[model samples]
Structure formats: structure tokens, C-alpha cells
Target: MIHLVQIIQRFVRIPTGILAIMIYTLIVYLIYLAFTKYIPMLIHQTFDMIQSVIDFYEHQPKDADPVLQYIHNYIERNDFFEQLQNGASIALGYLQDIGKMAVAFAMSFILSFFFMIEKQKTILFSRLFLKSEFSWFFQDLYYFADKFVNTFGLVLEAQFIIALLNTLLTTIALAAFGFHQLLSLAIMIFILSLIPVAGVIISCIPLSFIAYSQGGIRDVVYILMTILVVHLIESYVLNPKLMSSKTDLPIFYTFVVLLVSERFFGVWGLIVGIPIFTFFLDVLKVKKIPNHSPREIDIL
Candidate 1:
């Protein structure tokens, strides 16, 4: 936040607080747009994708390929569409819960904006207590408290950037292949890219299915190759550079954290499990995430 303020200071003269407010307001607006616009579109696209697949299965020619014929027969025999309807209803309820979370996030950003604006005053206010007879107690409390928040924030920011970049690159590859439903697929990619190794594998199943539906086995091979390349770049290039080295746990640990966190915190645990773990590590003074990372510094 301070770095952003400094960058803005060079362009036009403005009070630090006002600039901070402007930046944060822009962030809040983006968050609002994401929840109100992009997320709803993603949800609708998901439903459409499912419905279209069901329609394709139901309407296939009697003399269709053997595999597709078998798949269609299985769906018909199992009443798959009815099962999907039930799942869709449950997913809708989850989306509504997400809407509630958006409200909570907005409230948090608003409160944090006030804190950013009054940061200097808060520091001075704290210094008075820090210099008192109980200085050591207050100092340790304040230091650990601030470090915990920043550690979580750093990990979350890194993950978001990595996901966004992965989505963009993969979407470009799909577009180059003239894939259908690119917008919907891009949104899905972004959501799944939040997970680590397993996300790419899971995303591949749907992507390959869609690719095959569009252009047979040839397209499936092409998309699989694309996914493989993206996965390699994400794992080897993005993770090491963008992610904090401090939280650079092994693949086994990442999966374990995801599994345990998912069981305890539901879906969100997958997204936040790493960040929470990094925070605890910070509390132990185990490792550190640099304050001015190049990735974010280059952004503004």
C-alpha cells in the first residue's frame, strides 16, 4: 500500500491518505464487479455447459461412435440428468452463500481502508505504549500480530496472481485453437488454478472432454499437450518465482494441507490453507516473506 502511494506521489501531488483511499476504492469496486458480474456469468456458463453436454448426449444419432453410444446409454440408464439437476440446486445455494461472503469481504476492505488511511496515527499511538515500562510485552505482541497479517496477505496475493496468470495463458492457448465457450472455460480455469497440482489434473478432465466433443481425438491431444505445458510452466516457473520461498513446501505437504484444510474449512480451505500455514510459520519466526517482492512492485 505504501509503495503504491509512493508511486502515485511521483505522478501527482496528493495527500497519502487520499491516494490510499483512491487505490482501495478501486480495489473494492473491482471486487464488487467480480461478485456481481463475473461470478454470476461463470455460474450461468457452468449450467449451460452441463446442459449442453446433456443435450448432446441425449440427441446423438443412433449410429454414433461406439464410445459415445455407450456413454449415452449409461446416462440414460442411470438418469444422469436428474442427478445433475439436484447437484445444480445445491450449487446454487453455495453460490448464494458466496454472495454473503462477498458482503463480508466488502466490509473487511472498508475497515482496512480506514486503517490504511490512519496508519501513521496508529503507529504513533502504539509507540507511546511501546516506550512504556511494559515495552517488551507490547513490542512482542505488536510485532507478531503485524507479521501474522502480512504473512497471510503475502501468500494470498501470490496465489491470486499465479491463478490469474495461469488463466490468461491457458485461455490464450484455447483461443488459438479456436475453442468454443472460451469465456466460460477461462473462468473455470481461473477458479481451478487456485488449487495446486491437483487442479490442473481435474481441469484437464473437463477440458479434454470438451475438446473431444468439439474436434474429436485430435483436439483432445492438442489440449492435453497445452495443459501439460501450462502445468510445467506453472509448477517450475511461476511457483518458484512468484510464491514465497518461505512457504515453499513440498508437493506432498501441499496436498496434505489441502486435504486437511478442506475437511475442516470446506472449499475455502483449499484456497487459504497455505496462507494460514505460512502465518503460523511466521509466528514461529521460521522464515520470512520479503516486504517488497518484485512481482507486486512491478505491478504499480
Candidate 2:
């Protein structure tokens, strides 16, 4: 197994780094397009929802509550449509910034490509710059890098598997619920699922809102329940099994790390916290060894 991994890493190191950069670029581009194209439609949908509520209240009986009546009148008096238009115009400027970001990413890809090709030269240059007093520091850094790569790579593999499964299940559920735009929603969910606990919560809001818009409060309740169940499964079953298969940490430890990291660093902490914790555990040689009798041979 070690030999196979070494061989695979030897062949894939450069390609993997390049591929990672490309994937990041693609994700950024997709996000830019989604924001530029879909956000206006979403805003329009929200406006329609507001308008629908206002219209409903306008046709209500004369005995309607004074508070509700005041709210409805206030909505009618506001220039919501104009405000939405202005918001869309502001959003277009962000799209221009996204274009600049894409260009920067392209330059980064070029640099990474050259770095991959001249990896040996880069290592030589680093060594030449280091003083003899810092030799031990460099050795420790190398050790940390090796552990990080192996541990983090496993975590990524497990996460990819989880994300794919989550996407498939979410797509099926959306289709069953007769939701429109399954493809885009599924893609969004898959990408968000790569984040961690907060990702599931963040995805639920838009999904529930869409359900409410399409099929009322009951549909929203159903969608929320479905998401809750899926998240439970991911948290209790999939994450523990997959992460433990790669690293020795227990499920409880994983959750604790996620919570603490999120408290400190917010969303990005959730994404990287587990792998970072796993790398440290490995570096510290922490393991869970089973306690057994000396005659614990299998009877079968």
C-alpha cells in the first residue's frame, strides 16, 4: 500500500497541483456567472413574493388587524421595484470585479505551472537561502509538510465522496418534490457541502424559501425535515466512518474540533479544521489501540 501510494504521488504531484488551481478557477468563474445572471432573477422572485403578499392583504376583509393593514399600506407606498433595479445595477459592478479576479487566477495558474515544472530548482533555491542554524527548522517543516499532505489528501478524498453522495441525494429529493432548477441547486449544494456543518444550514434557507414559494408552508416544512434527516445521516454516519477510515480520530473529537475551529475562524475554519487537526494528531502519533486478551484469535 505504501509503495503504491508513493508511486501514485510521484506521478500525480505536479498534475494534482495544476488540477487544483484549474478547479478553483472554474469554481470562481461559475460563481461569477451565477451571481451576474441568476441573482437578478432571484431578486425579482422576492419582489413578486412581496407583491403577492401585499395584493392578498389589499383584498382582505374590512375587519383585518390594524397592524397588518399598516404594514400592507407601507409596502404599497415603498418603491421596492426601483430599489431592486438599483441593487441589480450595483451587482453588475461586482461582476466586473469578478472578471479582474479571474484574470488574477489565470496569472496564478501560469505561475503554478512554472513552479511545478521547475520544482527541483525551487527546492535548491530554498536550501541555498537557509542558514545552518535553521537546518533543524527546515527538517521539521519538511516532516510537517509530509504529514499534512498524506492526512489532508485522505480527508479531501473522503470529502469528495461525501459531496458526491450529498449531491445525488439532494438532486433526487428535489426532483421528487417537483422543484424547478434542480441542476443548479444540486451543483450549489454539492459545492457548499464541501465546507462543513454550516454549509448544510446555509443551503437550507434558499431551498426552504423556494419550497414555500412553490407549494406553501407545508412544502417548506417538508423540505426542512428532509434536509434535517439528510444532515443527521451525514453527521452521524458518513462523516465518522469516512474520516475514521482515513485517520484515527473519533467522531466526537471531529465534532469538537469543527465546533472550536468554527468559533475561532468562522466558515473557512469548518472547511480546513478537521484536516488540520488530523495532521496534528498524526504528527503527535495519537492512535486508538484496542484492548484485547492474548488469546484473541478469530474463532471463524
Candidate 3:
């Protein structure tokens, strides 16, 4: 471990501007590939899966489940092909939003590059204005901003680790079950798992639906149990261990904050709520308060 650390330190001491540029270029190329290839292929596979489901229902015996019968009747009445076309169109719209995101990423990269190259000048300029009559106010503001940004970054890092683990576990399980489109499903789960408490529930829907389409209730039940076990591990083990030391919030309280924030603020609330709550808790010194004596508690 000491040798490894020394090696890493030696590598870190090397000049990295060219390396950063190469990495950035590679990331841009990968994003382009996702847009031009992977996404379209995923869409095609999804449509194929839908078609397979339709074909399966078409050949089913008269003694099929009432729910499946109703679905077949509805698809027949509405024209499954037309519905598929509409769904595809909607998906294409979502893809356009990805293009917009790519543009934003490019802009951010450029801005960050400029900032990195001129970091000293940027600091000097900020200090010129900040170290003034209202220096105390600006200093306090900067401290708060720094703390908040650090906390937020740490939280995102922890969440990303959780998402990666979840995706890996999900991919292995899906493969064991002989599920098709394992790559796409794993990618989807990883993305969704970036959201807090409700992300698992959202990811389960498509997984369960696909399982049901493939092998009916038995497969769905198996997938559900797998999801339950994984979710339990994530909630009870990974989340507490990763976040507790950083946020100083109990797992139960963190969950409560997530639920309440989502209820009031919608989907984005799930992403930002816990970090914001933790930031406030830190700023307010909530955790630092000592336990009160019985007399003090009674007075309060």
C-alpha cells in the first residue's frame, strides 16, 4: 500500500494538461457514440421486445389470464403498430433533450478549461472585490458556499458509487435470469439509481414488466425478490455506511427527508433534498448540541 501510494504521488506530480485534453476528447467521442449508435440500437431493441410480447399474446390459448386478454383486446382495438409509432416519436423527443444536454456539457467544459488555465488571475480578481468594506459578509458567504459545494460533491460521489454497485449487481442478476437487453437495462438502472429513495421503485417497473413479458408471474416474482434483496442491502448497508459519516444524519431521518422533500418539490427534490438538509444541519450545529439534563429539558 505504501509503494502504491508513492507511485500514485509520482504519477500525480507529472504535468497533466495534455492528459486532461485527451480524456475530455474521449468523453466527447463516447457521448457522440451514445447519441448516434447506442440510443438508437436500444430503441430498436425495445420495439422488438414490444413486438415479441404482441406476438406471444397473439398465439396464446383461450385460457390466458384475464389481464393479458384485456391487454390484447386493447392493443388490437387501438392498433399496436400505431401505438408503437407514437411511443417511438415520444422517445425521439427525449433524445433531442439529450442533444441539448450535450451542448450544455460542451459549454461547461470550455468554461472550466478557461478557469483552470487562469486560476491564479481568477482568484486575484475575486479577492480584489471580496476583500473590501463588506469583506466580512463576503468572507462568510464564501465559506458557506465552499462548505456547501464540498458537501454536495461528496454526496454525489457517494451516490455514484452506489449507482455503479447497483448496476453491476443488477446486470449479474439479469444475466443469470437470461434476460435480453441486459446492457441497456443495466445502464437504465445506473442512471435511475442516481435519484434517491424513489429511484429503486421507478427502476423496478420496467424490470418487472420485462420479466412478466418473458416468463409471466413466476419470472416477475423472482425479479421482485431480487430487487427487494438488493434494495435492502442498499438501504440498510451501503447508504448508511457511505452517507452517515459525511452527513451525520441517521438513515431513517435521511429517508424521511427524501420522502418529504419529494412530496413537496417533485422529482428533483429527491436528488437535492438530503444534501441541502445535511448542509443546514451542519451550519446550524444541530449535531454538536450536547444532551440536556432533566432540569434543562423540563425548562425547555
TM-score of each: 0.84, 0.54, 0.73
Report the poorest 10 consecutive residues by lDDT, candidate 1.
291-300
Q: Return the top candidate by TM-score.
A: 1
Question: Native-vs-model 1 lDDT?
Answer: 0.79
The residue pairs that clash in candidate 3, if any, are none
lDDT of 1 at 207: 95
Q: How close to the true structure is residue 46 of candidate 2, measured as C-alpha lDDT?
A: 52
- The worst-scoring run of ten residues by lDDT in candidate 2 lies at 291-300
Alpha-carbon RMSD, candidate 2: 9.8
Tell me, by lDDT, which candidate is best: 1
Please give the ranking of all candidate structures by TM-score, highest first, separated by commas: 1, 3, 2
Over 197-257, each residue of candidate 3 has an lDDT whose tens digit, in order, gives: 6689888898887787788888899999988888998888898877655655665886899
Go through the candidates in order and give the clash count of each: 0, 0, 0
Off by over 4 Å in 1: 1-3, 10-13, 25-44, 132-137, 285-300
What candidate 3 gets wrong by more than 4 Å, as runs, is 1-12, 54-59, 63-103, 120-130, 247-266, 287-300
> How high a TM-score does candidate 3 get?
0.73
lDDT of model 3, residue 208:
82
| Candidate 3, position 23, lDDT | 55
Task: Please identify which of the two predictions, 2 or 3, would achieve the higher TM-score against the true structure.
Answer: 3
